[model samples]
Target: MTTTVPRTANSADTRGWSRWAAALILPIGPAAVAVLRYVLPYDTVDDSATMVSKVVAAPGRMSLVLWLGFIAVLTLVPAAYSVGRVTRQRAPRLTMVALLLLIPGYLSLGWLTAEDQFLWSGAKAGMDAGAITRLADAMHPSAAVAGVFFVLGHVLGTILLGIALWRTRVVARWAALAVIVSQPIHFIAAVIIANHPLDLFGWGLQAVGFAAVGWAILKLPNDKWA
Candidate 1:
C-alpha cells in the first residue's frame, strides 16, 4: 500500500495574506505618489508638472518625492501580478513577464509624472522656462510609449488572467467583472494621456486599475487550492 500526501486545505492563509496585501497595496502605491508630488515640489509643480524646470528648482526635495512615487508604482506591481495569478487561467509565464514589465513602465510613467510636476513647479517658482516644448522632444517618449505598453500588458496578460481566473475558481465573478472593466478604461485613458502627461485624471484611471486588482485579490480563494 502506498501512502499519498494530500494538499492541505489551507487556502485560508493565502486568502488572509492577499486580502491584507490588497488593502495595503491599494493605499501605499497611489498615496505615496501623491505625497511626493505635494510635499516635494519646491516650485508648486502645478502647470508644468512634467519638466526639468521643476527638478532644477528643488533638486533634493522634489527628487525625493518623485522617486518615492516611482517606488510606489513599483510596489504595486507584485500585488497586481498576484491577482492575475490567482485567476489561474493560463500563460502565467507570459503574465508574470508582463507584470515585471509593468513595474518599470510604471516607474517611467511616474518619472514622466515627475517631469510634468517639475515643470509646473518651475512655472510657480517664476523660473520662466518658456513655452512647453513639444512633448515628443521631452526626456524619453516614455510618457507616451509607456502608457501604450501598460495597456498592452494589461490586455495580453489579462486575457490569460481571465482564463486562469476561470480555471482557479478563486476569485468571485464580481472580481472578474471588475478586472475586465478596468482594462478598457485604462486603454482609453492611456491614449488620451499619451500627449498630455500632466493630466491627473488618466493617472486616476490607472489607479482605478489598482483598486480593481485589489478587490479581485480579496475575492480569490488563495494559493492552497493549487
Candidate 2:
C-alpha cells in the first residue's frame, strides 16, 4: 500500500506561498520600478523615436526593468485582492468597484511590460540596423493606441481604489491618498516638465503609495485579511 499526502496540505502550502509572495512583492515591486525608471535610459514622450532607438540599441537595462514590472504587476493582483477582501466586509460596494477598475489598469501596464520583451528579441535577432529601426518605428504607434486604456485602467482605477480604501479606513488615509494621487501627479509632472527627467518624479511618489498598501496588508492578521 502506498501512503499519499493529503491534497489539502499541498493546497494550503500553495496558498501560503502565494500570500508571502504578495506581501513581499506588493511593496518591493513598485518601489524598484520607481527607482529603476530614473536609472534607465528612457526618452520623454515627445521623443518616441529616441525611445525606440534606445531600446533597440541597448535593451538590457530597460528589459530588466520591464521584466521586473511584469512580475510586479502579477504580485500586485493578489495583494490588491486581499485589500479588497479585507475591506469588503466594511465597504462591499466600494471594494468591488475599486477592484473592477484597478484590475484593468494592472493588465494594461502588464501589456506594456510584456511588449518590452519583443524589443529585446528584435535586438538579439541580428536584424540589420534599418530592419531594427523600421521595427521600432512600427511598434511606436501601439503605445499611442494602447495608452487610452492604460490611463483609464491605472489612473482612474487607482483613484477610485484609493478613495474606497480611504472611506473604509482599510488603510491609512494618507497612504490611500498617496496611491490615489500618484498616477495623476506623475502624468501632470510629465506634461509640465515635458522632456526633463523630473517628469518621472511621480514614480517616487508611487513607491510611497505602494509601500503603504503593503504595510497595511502585512500588518493585519492573515485570517483577518487573507
Candidate 3:
C-alpha cells in the first residue's frame, strides 16, 4: 500500500506563487532581450576595437542594453526550471540533462556581463579602443571557461529541452520546433551570416516558443504546479 503525504498551506502557497512567477517570466525575459537586441546596433563580425568603439560612441544606450541583458539573465534559471518541470514526467532523463546543462549555462552569464562591464568602464575612462580590446582578451582562464560553458550549455541544452518538449507534447509542436531551431538560427546568424536582423529573428522564435510554454503553465491548476 502507498501512503499520500498532505501538502501544507505554506507549501501550497509557495507552489502557486512560484508557478505564476515562472509563467510570467518565461516569455517576458526572452521577449525583452529580443527587442533590446534589435534596439542595439550589434554586429557579430565586429572586432574588439569596433565593439569598444560602438560602446563608447553610445555609452548611455549600451549601458541600458547591458543592464537589460543582466536582468533577463537573472530570470533564465527559473524560466528554464519551469520548462524542465513540465517535461519531467514524460522525459525525465532528457529534462535532467537539459537542466544540468542549462543551470550552469545561465549562471555563467555573470562572467559574460562582467566582460561587457569591463568594456563599458574602459570606454568610459577614455581608454583607447585597442587598449580595451587587449584588456578584454586577457580575461582570466576561469572566465574563458565560463564563456565556453555558457555557449555550449545553453545552445545544446535548449535543443535537448525542445526535443523533450516535442516528445512529451506539452506545448504546441510548432512551438517545440521553434525552440529546437532557434539556437541553430542564432548561431548561423551570429557566426556564419553575421546578420543582425537574422539574429533578432532567431531570438524572436525563442520568445515565441517560451510564450507558448508559459501559457501552458498558467493553465495548470495550483495544486498541480508542484
Best by TM-score: 3
The clash count of every prediction, one per candidate, is: 20, 1, 0
- List the candidates' TM-scores in order: 0.52, 0.75, 0.89
The local distance difference test score of each candidate is 0.51, 0.64, 0.82
Judged by whole-model lDDT over C-alpha atoms, candidate 3 comes out at 0.82
Clashing pairs for predicted structure model 3, backbone only: none
Q: Compose the digit string of candidate 2's lDDT tens values, residues 1-226.
A: 9999767744554545555555566665556556555545554464545655677667677767676676667665665676666568877887788788767666666667655666667667765656755665676666655666666766676677777778878667787888778767766655555533443456566567666666666666656644
Error of 1 at 225 (Å): 8.3
Instruction: Show model 2 residue runs off by greater than 4 Å.
Output: 1-21, 137-146, 190-201
Q: What is the lDDT ranking, best to worst? A: 3, 2, 1
Model 1 stretches with alpha carbons more than 4 Å out: 1-19, 26-74, 88-94, 97-101, 129-148, 154-163, 189-226
Q: Between prediction 1 and prediction 3, which has the larger lDDT?
A: 3
Q: lDDT tens string, model 1, 1-226?
A: 9999877776324667756666467535644544453455433323443434545565666556656766776765665555555443554664566565555555455545555454555545656455433432455665667666655654555444544454554555554554445445444433443322232333343455456556655654655323
Best by lDDT: 3
Ranking by TM-score: 3, 2, 1
TM-score of structure candidate 2: 0.75
